[model samples]
Target: MNAPQTIIGQSPALSAALDHLSALATIDRPVLVIGERGTGKELGAERLHFLSSRWSEQFIKVNCGAITESLLESELFGHEAGAFTGATKRHIGRFERADGGSLFLDELGTMSLRLQEKLLRLIEYGEFERVGGSSTLKVDVRIIAATNADLRGMANNGQFRWDLLDRLTFDVVRLPPLRERPGDIEELAQHFAVRMSSDLGWSLFPGFTDEAMETLKGCRWPGNVRELKNAVERSLFRWGRDDAAVDEVVVDPFANFAGPFGGDSTAEDLADVSDSPERLSTGLPPRRDWPIDFQQCVTEYAKAILLEALEEASQQQKVAAELLGLSYDQLRGLMRKHDLRTRPPRRVSNPRK
Candidate 1:
């Protein structure tokens, strides 16, 4: 029953997407929304529904991945009483509830082949029979399917139905990930900060310092805007100082003084890390090499460790962050600080419908 969130961003990548969505909104056909997690696929779907001629009708949402196949079928198509073991009463499905409106199916790739067929039939003919029900029901429902998965690849592998994919692709709305729209990072951060500030009953929202904004902009938010919003709100809440500018954003709450290796990081852990027997014997110089540049040695050692971890994790930043016991942002900061490149920044062109 929840409405879609407000879409915020002035970046061309986002603006173009919005414009494309607006154009497609009036066309009452199945639309596929593709994007990484937190890229506002649902919001796009909501806009499509609200702007359509069926704006006054229901906007039902279903996460295909969250429910099991059998339950999902029943949920989508409804069921008569005694349809299954738990069917004590007649059930109304999402298709029935979403009659004359929009039905947003999230994680569409997770739907089973059988359900996909039924869905395809419904889309094509605008009619379907509920589970264990003899009566065929017809409903004028617009389909808005969203997924982060590779549906084309899945169809190629026979995991998803090509026919279903074909039907759903009457139009496609590909949302740009947060990394692709870096220009909006500060604006989003400020928006989140203000909302969080108001939640805390503050008179005025103090802004982020230059360092904090840099911290916000440095990392690739794999979870996209949702992750960024969490980081900003958490940093503001932890800062708890409304009067002063937020000088640090805690992108990773788990990061500690022990760097990435985040156990019970005591002083002993710190000393032991630097003064390990292997490090002293192989990595560092003895008293004879006391004149060695200490800072440079430490830098080289840190970089070596980081490189080793990255290699072990196959250069996946999130995996490397996990292996190093650091948050994604912390790992990114360390990589940047050490002048390490995991991979080149990728620019994904948003698809125009």
Candidate 2:
């Protein structure tokens, strides 16, 4: 099997983490990899496994943060037949299945306290019993746990067990955020652009001018690689004013950051009007035809945008208004009308470009 070529990154932090992973690839100890979501902690774990002596064995990935408490235990430790009402058959747990292989647990911080104890026990003794079975089974599986959340903070706050953390802390690997490693942005962009072109039949080299790339770089990507991929896809499909030239792709990633997330739209969710071809939220959208004057509509819309910007800017009103391109007075008036007059200064400094 060939190695994956999709993930292109060579930043300092990534290089250092790779160097450490390369060094510890064959150790088979519990590894704790930490990074923001979409920083590819799972990819790092795979790199470790594939580069190690266990390359020929299985590499299982589990999202500890995703599964619910009850389902999680059953998921980790294969349940015995009739372990609970839904257990119709005996199943092999991830640990047993990955014996002599690797088990990558993504978002380890979300595991419940009871599940954490079970995980600690599994790491300590290399053993675990089925959810309902009394017999303990031993397996030689390497454990690689990761989290985007602050596990250290969780441990400090007593949300996470000190002993459990200690057991999982044999080797620590930290991956830098997309914002931190500026050099890798271009490389990753090219890589993802090509992937987009191949997978979605979009332009191979994105229509983003050098100016556009700078905006991409300036953003604080809350969703990281996953968000970038989505943005690229949307640019190909939904961007432009329906007059995109062959080489002129006008994907305003800055605009994607608009309405609520990246900009100071007065509406907490301008995404209802976002160019995306889907609904922004689950609930019914606000009525477009309010039986009122246009001024009221703009004010109402501005207020919503302002509320959303508060979340992005930590409740700073001035920053929110500026993002909306509104004058301070105008913002204040709208806020007063909406009963959101209280606000801190807008935090926008001069644009980077």
Which candidate wins on lDDT? Answer: 1
Off by over 4 Å in 1: 1-4, 257-300, 303-353
**CA displacement after TM-score superposition, residue 185 of candidate 2 (Å):** 1.4
The alpha-carbon lDDT assigned to residue 333 of candidate 2 equals: 40
| Strongest candidate by TM-score | 1
lDDT for predicted candidate 2 compared with the true structure: 0.69
Summed backbone clashes in each candidate are 0, 12
TM-scores for the candidates: 0.77, 0.70
Residues 1-353, model 1: lDDT tens digits = 45556799999999999998999997888899899999999899998988888888999999999999999999999999998998999999999999999999999999989889999999999999989999999999999999999999999999999989999999888999999999999999999999999999988898988767877887789999999999998888899989999987787666543455443333333343344444222344335455776556666666666776666666666666666555556766666556689754234342111
Ten contiguous residues with the weakest lDDT in model 2: 274-283
Q: Which runs of model 2 end up more than 4 angstroms from their true locations?
A: 1-6, 202-207, 239-353
What C-alpha lDDT do the candidate models reach, one value each? 0.82, 0.69
Q: For candidate 2, write residues 257-341 as lDDT tens digits.
A: 4344334444433333332423222233367765766545655565555676555555654554455554343444445445674
The deviation in Å at residue 42 for candidate 2 is 0.8
